[model samples]
Target chain A: MTQKTDQDYILEVRSGNVNAYAILVTKYKDMMFTLALRMVGNREDAEEIAQDTFVKAYTSLSTFKGTSKFSTWLYRIVYNTSLDYIKKKKRVILSEHIDEIHEASIGTMQDAMSYLEAQEKKETIERALLQLPEEERVLLTLFYFEELSLKEITEIVHISYENVKIKLHRSRKKLYHILKNVVEPIYLSHGSRK
Target chain B: MEAENKKLDQFTKEVIQDAGLSSPSVDFLANVMAEVSKEESLVKAQNPLITKVGWMIIASLFAVFTFVLTRFSLGFSILGDWDLSSLMIEKYEMNVDIPITYAYCFFFLLVFVIIQINFIKKYFYRSLKN
Candidate 1:
């Protein structure tokens, strides 16, 4: 889908046309939620953070200087708010530990495990994504799902650009190891025996 | 480095496209915008003029109060032996020396004056012009 220029939306929203913000929210909600889901590892918390991010963006709308893309600012709020929620919850959600998830039965994972085996490996990768550390998870989510560049990710997370690169590398490596272990014979044996 | 980078890029692309992650619903955007509108309504309910005037009055009062206090403190000074000679001499036979407390008071008063004057000059010139 062709997205409208952020400048056009910002101008309209700032001029008291709040409905303009709806368009922006629609366009970026997926990107924002995906980032939150990865960091917090729960759909409920991700949805809450996503909603809170928009509310915050609205309240602080006037302070939004036009120097950076509005999406960058929006994503920063999502990342920070999700982090705050994670801290408040005091425990990582169970989804973060699962390395093998049967994709087809995502909706049915709670009822049956055998059904999940028929699903694609992609679901498992998402579950594996949750296993990553906060910094790495955020970097990967932003770079991949959000389609943000290294420089933009640096700005959103308030870290040095080099730090983003380093984290991205380490995180990707960890994700690969986790995914590989799940596919190995040891993992299969454990699953079959269970 | 190049090969690893290519592999990572490929993996990133694959994950984003193929992952079964649910996209945000259209209603989510509508809900957020509705919230923005609600906040806008709340801000609109408050009288901007009254808020600005109230802040201005507070700031002015603080400056005036600070100035008066500073001036009062500055005027108090330590009494000297000669200055108190008549009063002390008449009341008692003790010869005493009293040092003026003006230095500390005056220093503080000067600071208050500087602060007030600076605020007035800055505000009047910038705000009163247009």
Candidate 2:
């Protein structure tokens, strides 16, 4: 038998089988939570945002015209919910701080240390990701982690396609800068051994 | 410099691969299910079908009433020279006094509809809350 699709569950839910919605909630919870975590940087807040996103999606399921992929529609809800929380909390990403971050060039960083274990590099990357500004963090999460298409991301973030490309490029550079900051010290420490 | 840039790019790819999606707690689905159940109950309580049927029944009753009134008026006109007021009085005395019963039933139905409206309003208000 073919695997049941998101649309199958959606139709069932719309037909008054409310329990069918649980399948969708379970399927998308991890991605939604990760997106929220990247945007909010707080596990509790991320969980709350994720829960609210699912609840809102359930209530407004009828409005989901299915023009986009289910994941895209869901990510849009998660993105908007996290953005609302950030706005409500007045968590401003200072442009001046971004300018300072831009000054940290990845070109100057030492070469990658071969001795660094995979787990160590992973931890360092996660740390760098967490330290990034919310916008860059979220963009990276959506583009790299979730592997969403640029068009899908543009729809979710409600930005022009051109702007999404620009922001995505800038976010990549910002992530490189952050990764450089994180791994540079380790490179220096391992330089003597190399 | 070129080799170093290649190494950094490779390392970034590794990092990106390692930074996988985050999973919520085990109870996350259960919590969401609970909320869904609550919303479903609220929606079921305010089922639009029930509302539509209620309105349909009321409308049908009104239509029947209009038909009866038209028949009564036509009967009075057909009786031409007879005293209309005395005929009404005689009909009331001989048959069941429908006016008094109709007034009482209408008043009770009005109260029932008002109560139902208030109940539906309260259900909506509760549903809109967190």
Candidate 3:
């Protein structure tokens, strides 16, 4: 069975088969949910935002002009939807001002990570990710996990490619700053043994 | 410095990929589909049964009929050559013949107004929520 493309399902939807949208929703739901969850940092509100994004996407599907890939367009919608939600709720995410790193050794960070159990690594990364500013979390996730190009992210985030590159760099630096702090104790313990 | 940054970037990428993406509740797909279906229905329902063009056509026909009725006069002009003012006066005179009290009439008018208001409110409630 050849899996239908996103465009195929979209055309079916445009032609009046409303149920065809279920396939597209199922296809993208995980990525959508994860991205929304990362943006909002709460499972319940993340689910709601994901739901609203799908509904908004369906309602305004006609406006899609095929100028970019469907997933890119959908990302743009979810991105804006999350922003609107944050603005409406008057959410104030306390930001830790991250300085540019002068010396944070990757070898020590790797040693600390290998020292921890698998579950601890997962929880530690997620916890630290949640603490970073909202936009950076989104930028890093889209850049690394989704492997979206700078041009695609530029379209979704409405920033120039140069800014996207700069932000992505800073986001990586910020995330490294957070993850390094979590394993700083392990590094110190290894130093005492030496 | 750039080479060091690249190594750190590669390390973060590996660790993040290892931790993996977060999954929503098991019912997330069903929930979003439910909302989508609901939104589809709302859009469908908002399409007025009588389109604006339809209403315009009906209004044009009605105006034509009203004008024809007003100009309607035969060689035999019964009811005073079909004079509209006289007919209106006769209708007013017929109102005087009714046995209803003015207070009852006012009360009934108020009740009908309240009912109409309630009907409009009921019709718009769902749309307002959307």
Candidate 4:
């Protein structure tokens, strides 16, 4: 039997089979949860936002005309919902200005990332992600980790294509700046202890 | 400079992709579905045969009708001399004078009703929004 597409599940949901919605929630919950976690830096808040995103999507499923892919539509909801939650809670994301980081930091990032082991690298990336501001942090997650294209990112994020590119570039730089700090200690520990 | 930046971008992407996806706690899916189920029930429960506003309008009309029926000597004229006597009785059989207090109360209710409808709607909206 063929695995049902997102659209099939969406159709089932529209016809009132609530269990079909469970299939959708199962499929994309991780994506929504990860994206929300990246944005808020708290697992509890992230989970709440993800749950709310699915619930909101289910309720508003009828309004979804088949104009775009369902994942893209779903991404848009999760993105806005995260932002709304952040705004409502007045959580300080510590908006760091990207331009202030020196250009030299960018050169070291690639080399430093290569030196770390897989698990260390992953932890470093998460640590670095939490340090960056909300908007750029999400942009990086979608573009690089999720492997979504710039155009797809634009659709989900509702930013102009050009702005997405520019922000992605700046976000990369800002992320590397944070990663640089975290990796230096690990690098020394590897040399001295390992 | 350009070559270096491209390499940097590649390494960044590789490093993040290597980090892999994060999973929520074990019960995440159950919790989400529970919320969805609750929402589904709420959607099904709303908009009964006559909604709150519908009932309000019907009640208002009924009150006005009963007042008219009881206060004034009732009559029905569907056509020229087509007397359906069930509705044709000279009902209540009283000549009532409109008291100033009644008019005052009626006007107050008229204004209060507009405010009341808005308040009720907002109240329901806030409750249902959660």
Candidate whose lDDT is highest? 3
Give DockQ per model, in order.
0.22, 0.34, 0.40, 0.41
- lDDT: the better of candidates 1 and 2: 2
Q: What is the interface RMSD of each candidate, in Å?
A: 7.1, 4.3, 1.8, 2.5
Write the residue-wise lDDT of candidate 1 on A75-194 in tens digits: 889989987887888865432333333333232322222323535456777877777777677788778766789999988898999999988877766665565555444445666899
**Candidates ranked by DockQ:** 4, 3, 2, 1
> What stretches of model 2 exceed 4 Å from their correct place?
A95-115, B1-13, B48-50, B64-124, B127-130
- Place model 3 in a CAPRI quality band: acceptable
For candidate 4, lDDT tens digit of each residue in B4-68? 56766876787678777888888988987888887777766664788889999999999999998
Q: List where candidate 4 sits over 4 angstroms from the true fold.
A: A95-111, A192-194, B50-122, B125-130
Model 3, range B48-69, lDDT digits (tens) per residue?
Answer: 7899999999999999999977
Report lDDT (Cα) of residue B113, candidate 1.
99
TM-score of chain B of each: 0.31, 0.44, 0.45, 0.48
Record all residue pairs in model 3 with backbone atoms less than 3 Å apart, i.e. clashing: none
* Kept native contacts, fraction for each prediction: 0.49, 0.58, 0.61, 0.71
Interface RMSD of candidate 4, in Å, is: 2.5
What is each model's TM-score for chain A? Answer: 0.77, 0.86, 0.90, 0.87
In model 2, pairs of residues that clash are none
Better of 1 and 4 by TM-score: 4
Tell me the deviation in Å of residue A112 in model 3: 1.6
lDDT, candidate 1, B18-90, per-residue tens = 5645566557777776667666766675445668779999999999999988876766566543475456564
Candidate 1 vs candidate 2, TM-score winner: 2
